[model samples]
Target chain A: MTSAILVSILMTLVAASTPILLAALGELVVEKAGVLNLGVEGVMLTGAVAGFAVAYSTGSTGAGLVAALVAGVATAMVFAVLTLSLTANQVATGLALTIFGIGASSLIGAGFVGRTITRLGPAFPEALSGHPLLRAVLGHDIVVYLSLALVLAVSFFLNRTRPGLILRAVGENDASAHAIGYRVIAIRYAAITFGGALAGLAGAYFSLALTPMWADSLTAGRGWIALALVVFAAWRPARLLLGAYLFGAVMTAELQFKAAGVTVLPPEALAMAPYLATIAVLTMMSLGPKSGRANAPACLGKPFSAS
Target chain B: MTSIITRRRFNFGAGASAAALPFTAGRALAQAPLGVGFIYVGPVGDHGWTWTHDQGRLAVEKEFGAKVKTSFIEKVAEGPDAARAIRQLAQANNQIIFTTSFGFMNPTIQVAKQFPKLFFEHATGYQRADNVATYNARFYEGRAVIGTIAGHMSKSGQAGYIASFPIPEVVMGINAFHLAAKKVNPNFRTKVIWASTWYDPAKEADAAKALIDQGCDIITQHTDSAAALQAAEQRGVFAFGQASDMKAFAPKAHLSAIIDDWSGYYVKRVREAMDGTWKTGDVWGGIKDGMVKIAPYNDAVTPAARAAADAVQKGIVDGTLHPFTGELKDQKGVVRLKAGEKASDELMSKMDWYVDGVQA
Candidate 1:
């Protein structure tokens, strides 16, 4: 009975964490190339509504996921043009992107309100789902497996490739990359677009798999949580998966405590557990030791300019 | 023949020709399309409160036919967005505007004062003026019937209530339901969960499940969703539905539902307004008037439960019963109503505190 319950809970944790995992993976790539985009939430939400609206009308969940990615990438292109091409402040541009995305998505999603859509199929093959341990790890919507694979692929790309080293060089010191004849602006723009498409896919996972319904403010700060996960992972692709899943487990436990008939604390306190833990972990990581910030990219939020 | 006489009598100095008839023709053309508009705080789907109101709009169109032209804007925000929606409707030539929400009261009043020619009707609010009339269903009257069913059906003496906000309307409902529940079972206690938002299914479900985990076998809500019913069904507990009939959402678990029938009132008011006989007034309708109705009880309810609910329904409809009649205690255990006394409109309107037996 305990094992069955654990399996069910782990399955829920995967579903809950997919959007965050997909989004943070993209931001991980962006950060590795040395750009800070706070507009991740805004991009995710726009994708969520846009993807659902299209899927709802077209009766195609795959189409919906693709549309979400395109919407995310498109919004990122807007940011790239303004910040990368115009040399505008990245922080201000990202904030404006979020504000714009919120208003634009609301307007576009107005027609699809209160409509329901077909639920997406599971991510893994039925053969894999039949296995005990593999079932718990792999039985999710298609986006979940893709996001997990993305982390592994990103880890390999960032650590094992010459292009990855060049991107890192651009981030750590764009002046040094420029001396070596690397195109700094082009790399950052590509990173930003990649970040947005991932954020969009995260949003699609929400509408396409999680609730399968459209609602205002549906993402509910999942983007912000993903943003925080980047720091919690210390800029490592593999660590991001652990951080995202851990936060997902914390959230799932709070809900399951009531479901499983365990009433150790008031429901309100339990409801706040995940957010409180995030804050606690962040404080510990920031204040505990000098070694904590060692893994963060040195030029994570700094913008580069060529004279 | 009347036009000829009126044209000569009113325009005595005018020549007797077709050019003199242009004024009357222009008047007829000006009154060609009568615009009607609705402002919503949430999206209008095929379910819930906003959907129900949108149904009323469709009813108005069907009732009036081509006499009225209707348009709507959904998901209008509570404060400034409400004001903008109202102005847009009025400026677009909507002579009759229905602003549907409690938070929309002040904004509706503000817009009504500015556009005196337009008739504004605010739902679930008390403030009223010449052009700004307020109307709401006597939802507590429906609660009295459902509470009686819950009182008989609940194996545990604990009942759960999912309430939205601490305003008078919701507070009155909580008090009324607890009073009715206590009348049947003296040991009955209500666990109240305030969600603080009008339509959040996830929050409402979580709250309902929390209450059930705390030993509540029966539940009811003053919010606007079938989520509580869905939650109750998942937990194998029974609950009453709110705003609209939610039998489809949780057929087995839903004992019954309190349905808001705004069509009758909407038709009457719009007809009167178009005929120039409309007068601003509060229309707080109850079960007797068919504005509030109880849906069919589920089979899970015992024979005794059915009889009790039916008796209350008959009493309300036949004027033999009043939900707020006789001795009643406030949240402080102070008796607010004595035996043989009927609850006053003033007290019911300003009911800010919960009654005894309600755990907030």
Candidate 2:
């Protein structure tokens, strides 16, 4: 391929990967704090609609992003309350949140259908953003950079900081942390809220940056794929970034081959490639050393009452 | 005066006898405001397939005024859920129910059997019973017009088609676009990509960008979203919208669109049922019947190209042009239709093979 074509492909790949990476990173933190919230998909949908509606009505992309973050956090709290307080089944409650998100987003977004918004544009100046050679690196919107920065920050926070250590301690052994006076429940709530915020931002990425238009169920189950990425990453923020990009590349390969007039495989097979790759990667991750399986928190998915 | 009196008496006698018949009892009950119900497979706000259908429902309400009462449930999933939804409409006393999705075919038939007194209409489906009727638009006719425009406007002679499925309806559109493009430039080629979905904006946008990167100057989609058109606009390529006019989404890149106009048919069918003339049959209406229309050309289209497109549309409407005429060959170089022979409705409905110059 030509250099220009390669750059175009890279650009599309980055765009495709950013949302999942953002969502997966948040889930990684939540799981690290010993909570499993499967409501990522639903929260994302709510964020998508909230972002689109706010952006369309106010004609401001920043306001729209804020709205999406709020919507995401709010939706996440529903799961947090039910699972963290009421002691509901994490799996069942997460699934219910997704269904509710689909219905509620559709209802909320009903008026915004067919509406268009000015897409979130590049953050840098046109001199660098428009240069053919430098454009690939500089042309991306703010969210793409934010996602990468978050990966690094999360990696540092989980492995280096004192609070990060405490959060990990709570996840590893909630009872011991509770006895140590770490406020296990409060930390878990905070972690869940953070996850919800990131998921909301990821969801808004679809509406405000990726497609720049509104439609019902626009996320199209990408949220579920983000959930899978958390496991594929073994709950590591850095690995989550790599997994998200890998998935993005696999997703773009089908379109690339068809566009290049390479008909080696049928269209159906090409469409199935990314999904098959997801399953394969997950299986390979599980097949590694038994210690890899131990990466999951001991207290993960277990509710702590501290009574 | 005596002759007029006799005629009036004869008309009254015929009407009384028709109402007295057991089979016509349901028609007699139509004197009350006719209730029309629509079942959509997607949200009405989709701005594509379902949106057009909902527009038709609105037309029925506008045309009949208080004589007709219309209701619809959007995003109704096909299969078992469809049957229940249809049954609920029937129970609510909707005299005519329009199930607007191919997947709803069997369910529509099943529900019709349970509610024999109701009139049923299914879109893009083949099944029919005494109470069931099937209707479709000749969308290929509109495709041919746009294809001719794409051929004339494209600089690279390569067009990209983002298809939803390999169903006969979508396959036929691909073949029709290629055949028309080839007529303009025999060396013209079309690249086809299957998204495997009817409406995913992100996937559709990616497909458009990929095609544009590989030298496709014009893009068209059978999927229901404006993403492809928006991509074309951003990439400075030409595109045609699907199902509805998406000119607003991509004002500069949108050359023209094949708009599905179901208002005429919906209004007519409702009128037929209201007048007790409804029947079980098939209706395939095209440009002539006002079922398929071409949107206005963009400012980018040359006057010559615009005239050519208009000519093609006129030819199809006047029965002088046939998209699947003789001299057609499949991708394997086997003749599908010999010269001077026109394709029958049955053959067109199940067309699965691509014509020459189509790359899938």
Candidate 3:
């Protein structure tokens, strides 16, 4: 029974973590090339509304997913031009991008209120869907599988590939990279855009797969969770999966506790568990020996300069 | 064929399409008209408060025809974003603006002061100016009935209330529910849970479950979301819906719902504004006025329950029933109203204390 619960919990975690994982992986890549796009939330929201609207109109979930990616990329391009091209403050520009994305998406989603989209049917591998322990541990819609695969793929690219190494070197020391004849600005822009695409994909997953409907402000700070997960994973790709899943499990447990008849805690307290856990994790990580320089990229928030 | 020929001939003579055209079309076509703007804090769905207001807007367009043009921005954030959004709408030539949301009260008042000629209507606020009119539904009237029903139906002598804020509007509902529940079951007590949000499904669901786990069998909410109904269904508890009919989310669990109908008020007010008859006043309408409605009772309600609810409904409509009749007690059992005394508007408006049966 315990194993069954454990397996089911794990499966649920994977499903819940996909959007965050997909988003974090993209940010992982972006960070490796030294662009900090704090506008992931806005980009994801844009993707969510756009994807839902298109899918709603076209009656095709695939089309909706594509539209989400495109929306994310388009919004990201705006951020790229402002920060990467115009040499604006990365943090400020990223914040501005998030604000713009929120306003635009909210405007678009207003008319979509209370409208139902056709649910995307199950996407788990057939064999695992029916299996008892295996099903609970492995089964989920496509987003979960995509998130896992992307994590592994990102880890491989960052550790083994020539271009991935160059990206990392640029993030670590852009001046040194510039001196060595690599185009830092171009690399960071590409990385930021790719990050935006992934964030968009994450947003699409929310509307197209998870809840499968459009809602105003529906992302509910999930983007911030993705960003925090990046830090919690110590900027490593493999740990991102574990950290996101763990947070998902904690969130799921809060709901399940009330469902399974735990009456000890008040509902407000239960609702606060996940946020409180995030705070605790942040505090623990900050207090750990690896403090400042161990996990974060040295030039994580620094903008690339030609000089 | 003969009928079709006659219908065609009738159409030619009657000019149905031409008649359907707005008489104001000529005037509108002569010059570009001023744009009107609406800003909402919620999405305009088919049910609930926002949906009702949107329906009202559609009514205005239908009534005024082409002479008046109105547009809306939905799900606008409260503080700075609201200011910017209002400015944007004003810049876009919106001469009149309606800002909906409690948080928009001060901002709307401030913005209206900035644009004196521009008319502004705000919902659920007291602040007003020559151009700013305030409006709200008398939600407490509906709560009084729900309270009575809960008082009669509660099996566990415990009820749960999902509240959105600590404001007087929400607090009044909580107190009213508790008072009514106490009338039916003197031992009955209520657990008040604040989710601190108007609409968060996950949080609302958990709150419902928590209340149920604490032994509350009847649930009422002053928040948005069908999650409470969903939670009640899972727990096989009796619940009441808020804002919108959430029967789809909790068909078996929901006893009834409080639905807001803004179309009537909206159409009247907007037309009045367009006709230059719109004066700054506080409009608060309830059951008797048809602004608030209780949906059909579910199958789970017993014959006695149905009869009781029907009787209450009749009383409300015929002025024979009073939800806030005299002889009410505060949480400390202090008598706030004497027997046969009607609850004053002043008392209801400033009600900040919970009744005796509610557990804070």
Best by TM-score: 2
Q: Model 2: per-residue lDDT, tens digit, B202-263? A: 99999999999989999999999999998999889999988898987898999999999999
Ten residues in a row with the worst lDDT in model 2 chain B? B1-10
Give model 3's DockQ, 2 decimals: 0.11
DockQ, cand. 2: 0.38
lDDT digits (tens) for residues A1-307 of candidate 1: 4554566556667777788889999988888888888888789889998899889989999999999999999988888888777877888988777767766776688687656676677766768778657677666777877887898888998999988888888778888888889999999988888999999988887777766666655575677778888877878888899998887777666545543446567656754665676677667777876555556667777767787
**CA lDDT of every candidate:** 0.78, 0.87, 0.74
Residue-by-residue lDDT tens digits, candidate 1, B232-309: 876689988787777766778988889888888888888888888888999899998888989988989899989988
Chain B fold agreement for model 2, TM-score: 0.91
Q: Write the per-residue lDDT of candidate 3 for residues A95-126, one digit (tens) a residue.
A: 77777776687678868766656555557666
Model 2: per-residue lDDT, tens digit, A1-307?
6888888898999999999999989999999999988889889999999999999999999999999999999999999999988999998998888888887888899899887888898878868866566879898899999999999999999999999999999999999999989999899999999999999999999999989988888888888889888887778887888899988987788788888878667767865665676677667767867634548888889888887
Off by over 4 Å in 1: A1-25, A46-170, A181-194, A208-210, A228-307, B1-30, B148-160, B178-190, B199-202, B208-242, B246-256, B295-307, B325-327, B330-332, B339-342, B355-357
TM-score of 2: 0.94
Docking class of 3: incorrect
